[model samples]
Target: MERIITVRAEINLFDGSRSGKTTGYKSGIRPNHFFEGQTSSIAGDIQFEGQDELALGGKCFAIVRFLYPEWFPPVVPGITWRLHEGLRHVGDGRVLEVHSGR
Candidate 1:
C-alpha cells in the first residue's frame, strides 16, 4: 500500500501584486501544490501552525498532507513549491521534512 505523505514546510503567502489571495488562508484548507519547475499541481491540504489564519503576505510554517501522494515527485528538504487556488498562485513553500501520514 502507498503510504500517505506529509511534510513540514515554510509557506509564504503573496500579496495582491502577485495575484495572490485577497484575504488569507486558514488551517486545514486544501490547495494545489505546484512543485518547482512544474506547470501542473497536485492535491494537498495545508494546516498552518499556531495561528488560525495566515494573512496575505505572511510567512509561516505549515504541515502539508498530499491527497494523491503518488502524483508528486520525491519530496525532500529544501525543495520549493507553490500553493494555488485553481490556476492562480497564492503562496510559496519549501519542504522542511517528509514523513508518513494517516
Candidate 2:
C-alpha cells in the first residue's frame, strides 16, 4: 500500500483546571513536567515504528503520531507519522517554532 503526508500532530505541554467530575482545560492535554516523586502521572518517551504513511480506507495518505492517551476515544481515523532523512521531496528542515515552558 503506497502512502503520503496527510497530517501532523504537535504534542505540547498542558496545565489543567479541576472542576466537579472533570479535571482538565479544554485548551489541551495536560503534560507532566516536574517530579514530585508522587501521584498518577504520565512519564515516558514516544517513538515511531514502521513507515510514515497512512491510507484512508485504501487511499494513500501521510500519518503523524501524536501522544494521545490510549483511553481517549478514537476522535479520527489514521495516525501521525514520522518523516525520514534524504528520503524524498522532504527537505533539510528547520525549527519552525518552539515554546520552552519554564
Candidate topping TM-score: 1
Q: By lDDT, who's the top model here? A: 1
For 7-35, candidate 1 gives per-residue lDDT tens digits of: 99999989877854578888988888888
Candidate 1 backbone collisions, by pair: none
In candidate 2, stretches whose alpha carbon ends up further than 4 angstroms from where it belongs are: 1-60, 75-102
Which tens-of-lDDT digit does each residue in 4-92 have in candidate 2? 22222332211212112122112221223121222233222222124332221111211222333444333232222222212221111
TM-score of each: 0.85, 0.16
lDDT of each: 0.81, 0.23
* Residue 91 miss distance in model 2 (angstroms): 21
Clashing pairs in 2: 4-62, 6-62, 63-80, 63-81, 64-79, 64-80, 64-81, 65-80, 65-81
